[model samples]
Target: MATLILVRHGRSTANTSGVLAGRTPGVLLDERGAAQAAELPARLAGLPIAAAVSSPLERCRETLRPLLDARPGLALHTDERISECDYGDWSGRKLAELTEDPLMEVVQQHPSAAAFPGGESMPAMQRRAVEAVREWNARVEAEHGPDAVFVMCSHGDIIKSVVADALGMHLDLFQRISVEPCSLTAIRYTRLRPFLMRLGETGDFGSLAPRPAKESGADDGRAVVGGGAGAP
Candidate 1:
């Protein structure tokens, strides 16, 4: 069996502004996100993280700052397969504005195969996301032996795909599971089956995590949903 740690990116400008940001370039993490990133290392203190993998996106890379700062010796492996689903024309658009698009209709009725006007199909996204983690798990077990601990930094949808896969839920139900940003999830797997050790648990992988400050209103760092790995 292998122990795996999954982390979603920190809060981005897109996140705070309520934009979809699917495969959008240079969206980057904001100041609060940088602060949030710094807190991760402490949360992961004492944990033996053997390998770190990340999605091939700017947001995902910025999320790696905390984990990398905590473990500079760890090399980051970039995986395109772990990237957020391409939102195509909808990329960088606000959610409320997107609600009226015809694309959402397809997503509502046939989520698994729902393809945005120019976005990726849900089924394809789910398959690749699941494969990204499974492939990494296999590699970790093979290279570092069966008990190796690995960390993965990815996007919200990708993390949901992983949880849904682990729980044997339908691909279309991705929105049902709420994985918070910067939250960490741990999955253990053997030749027989896969088990969830932690689901949408924040402050579990990186070391030296500082407590997040309180927000003015209801927008404090409280978990919004299990939409991603670790939504800190």
Candidate 2:
């Protein structure tokens, strides 16, 4: 099996606008997002990336652009399975307004039962994304080698779901995991089990230092419908 470098696409216009942007066609990276994309080359400088895959969405593609430019020889492929969760009628709607929807609570705490009125279920989303990774892992190993490392640029929820699968967590619990825009998560797969090498690495160790705890909040457990705007 190969090492997987899971990347959440850089922050996008929708991200900052508080829209869900689920499978939205025209959502592109914002200014800070472009800067984050530009940093990809240096972020994984030493790894011999074997292959690259991205969600068939503009934001994900734009996020991988700088890295692909730096590695001209690495071919980039698009997989729809790893695209953002189909938010159905919720697509393009503001997250704040969605908070009032009854289904939002199910999405926050028991995502396994949450399904968009016109979209896919959370479990289905996880299954497809995990399947794509499995197929890619075998393909990379056959074409490159077991020790090969590959990168896949995808949406925040998709990346979080993949990480949850890698850690043997249920889809309902996936929302507890978060990956900031342009964050990198690494996983190593073997015949026995997958190892999570890193989770949400933004190259900011200062963020790891102890911080004062705030008062318990009402929305503390709510997962941002779309990954919320990254650290500001």
Candidate 3:
């Protein structure tokens, strides 16, 4: 089995301002976001991370900068599949204003059936995000062996969607999952099935170290899904 760590990017200027941001260019991480990013290397200090994959968006990239700096030898890659959702007409809108829109109701209660006015559907977003993780999981296992661990830096909604798929929960119910900025979620992929080790863990990880190598057949475990509010 291989371990996959999904990290939501640190807070952005848009996030602090309560803006949707959605694929908009020039949106960088706010000062608080920078502080959050700076804390990652320490949170992940002892893990044997083989690679660091990130969304192509600037915020995601900026969020990953410190980690890369701490581990210069670790390889880094960018994948568009993990980028922020294309919010279409809703892009850059305040969440408070969108609350009055009828679509907002569907997004909160039944995301699987919801589609942005002129943007991508929730189902489509989940499909691509899940597929991207699966591909990376296989690649990491092949190149770094079954015990390899890696990180994926992405957005709030996308992380929630991926978490939903990992737990085999309906996309509509993904609203129950919450992923805060710079939070950490982990999943272990095995031939039998995926095992979710943690979700939305926002504490200091300085004490959390990598597990020792295990013998075969020790991969099976109970599936646990952590819960919270809907995506940002």
Candidate 4:
């Protein structure tokens, strides 16, 4: 029952503008973002966090800082392997505003074969992130029992990809789960199989309170998040 607590970073400046922000540096959380970070620590009040691993990005580090402040014993480590997929030239571009291109259409239809014009492919991102998570779990299981809890803080897209991999999801329908600024997702591991106990939800963080989601076009966490967007 080792608990793996996955977190998406707080609201970033890029998030406010809907930019790609792939592997970009210096994207700190907005004023609201800092507030969100301060609120999440209460969510893990008494749990033994064991280790606080981040995606080696500034925003991810910012997200984990509060948790570390509350729980002094929790070790903080960085792993580039868990960072967000490189959006390449798409970095900083609004997905909604991107020109309609044939390759974009191809990837929308054939995910494994599609690649962002200047970024990593979905399959590639998935492959490495999955491995990083697997290794993180192994270390925790080795030291703490399999029932121990391990915390990971990362980007929305990366967290979404990792969640999908653990639950067997696909490319599209990613919005099914809104990895809100400073949100948490829980997954349990038995032997080698991963079982999701929770998706993106504001459960309990130390001092952080999740921001309210938009009214319309919000994700339902019913599809594309795990077990594929359309899986039953």
Candidate 5:
């Protein structure tokens, strides 16, 4: 088995704008996100990342650019399954606006049953994402050896779903997990079960501080359709 490192793409324009970028076109990383991506190589200095995979979106590609430059020989492959959920008609809408949509409640409390108006269901998204990771895990292990580690740059929702599958948590509870922009989540897979070695290592301890009740519960149990803007 191989270790899988999941890297959510750096914050994007849509993130800062409070919109669900989904698979929307032209949503590239914002200035802060570009800086975050630039710092990735130094952050992952010692890992022997065997293979690199990314969502086809521009932001994911941009996030991996610096890392790829540092390891010029590492091949970069794009996997649509790891792309942001096909938000379809909801793609470019503001999150605040969507909060009023009736579907928002289902997405927050019962994601396994939520389906986007014109896009894919939450369950469908999880299935494809989990399958992609499982397939890639075997491929990397077979080709590179048991100790090999591979990285995949994907989206917030996609990463959460993969993490849930790895943790054996039900999809309905996946919203409880959060991975900030450019955060690294590592999972080691074995014959029997997978172990989550690291979860959302952004190297920032600010999140550990207690949050004010108002700010914390306002969005409690809600899955930020697209990962919300990370730290101020």
Candidate 6:
């Protein structure tokens, strides 16, 4: 097992404006987002991150820039699987305006059964995002060893979906998980099961330090542990 840190890209123009950017091109981080990105290097400075991966979107790429700068030797890779959900016809629409659409209710309450009119079903999104993380987890471990740590910068919904899978929760319940922009969520993978070390952490690196050993009764006797983080 290998550690995967999931990072949600910093706030973007679409975020502040209340529009669903979806796969829209040219959407970049806003001023506050840049500041958020700037602080990430220090937040993650002490971690032994071996590689950096991000969505192809500009927002994700911009969010990863500082990390790359801080770790000049880290290789940056892009994977489309972790990209934002395709909102299809709803892409670029205002969330407030979309509230009137009947599908919004399904999206809010029964996401597992909801599908964007011209886009993907929520369940399908979860499957792909979960598979991508599993695949990368294995690859990183093989390349950098079982203790390797890596960063994955992605979108809000995608990170939430991944978190839901890690927690063994169903897709419909994924809505209950909230990921903030530029936040960090850590997960540790072991041979027996995934351990959620942290969730939706922001503006602090205090918890990023190596976790304390499990107390006597808390030990599960699992080996090959890895760390994970999710940022939205």
Give the top-scoring candidate (TM-score). 5
Per-residue alpha-carbon lDDT of candidate 3 for residues 1-232, written as tens digits (9 for 90 to 100): 7899999888788876667888889999888789889999999989999989999999889988999999989878999999888788888887657767888778877788888888888789889999999999999999999999999999888998998888889987887776777889999998988988999787854323444322110123211111111122
Ranking by TM-score: 5, 2, 3, 6, 1, 4
lDDT of each: 0.75, 0.89, 0.80, 0.70, 0.90, 0.79
Q: Provide the TM-score for each candidate, comma-separated.
A: 0.85, 0.94, 0.87, 0.82, 0.95, 0.87
| Per-residue lDDT value at 110 in model 6 | 83
- lDDT for each residue of candidate 6 in 1-232, tens digit (9 for 90 to 100): 7888899898788876667788888889888789889999999988999888899999999999998988889989999898888888888787557767898778877888988989888788888888888888888999999999989999888888899888999887777776667988887788888888778779655434555443111123211000112122
lDDT of candidate 5 over 1-232, digit per residue (tens): 7999999998899888888989888999999899999999999889898999999999999999999999999989999999999988898998889989999999889999999988999999999999999999999999999999999999999999999998999999998898889999999999999999999899997755677744432446566777776775
Q: Residues 1-232, candidate 1, lDDT per residue (tens digit)?
A: 7898888888788877767888887888888677767888888888877899999888778888777977889899999888988877888777657766776756655578677668677788889988888989999889988888988998877887888898888876666566667878888987777898998776344422443433211133222221422333
Candidate 3 total steric clashes: 0
Better of 3 and 6 by lDDT: 3
Query: What is the C-alpha local distance difference test score of candidate 5?
Result: 0.90
**Could you say which candidate leads in lDDT?**
5
Which of candidates 1 and 2 reaches a greater lDDT? 2
**Better candidate number, 2 or 4, judged by lDDT:** 2
Q: Write the per-residue lDDT of candidate 2 for residues 32-134, one digit (tens) a residue.
A: 9999999999999999999999999999999999999999998899999999999999999988789899999999899999999999998999899999999
Q: Candidate 2: which stretches are off by over 4 Å? A: 205-219
User: Which structure is stronger by lDDT: 1 or 4?
Assistant: 1
Off by over 4 Å in 1: 203-232
Name the weakest run of 10 consecutive residues (lDDT summed) in model 2: 210-219
What TM-score would candidate 5 get against the native? 0.95
Ranking by lDDT: 5, 2, 3, 6, 1, 4
Which ten contiguous residues of candidate 1 have the minimum total lDDT? 215-224
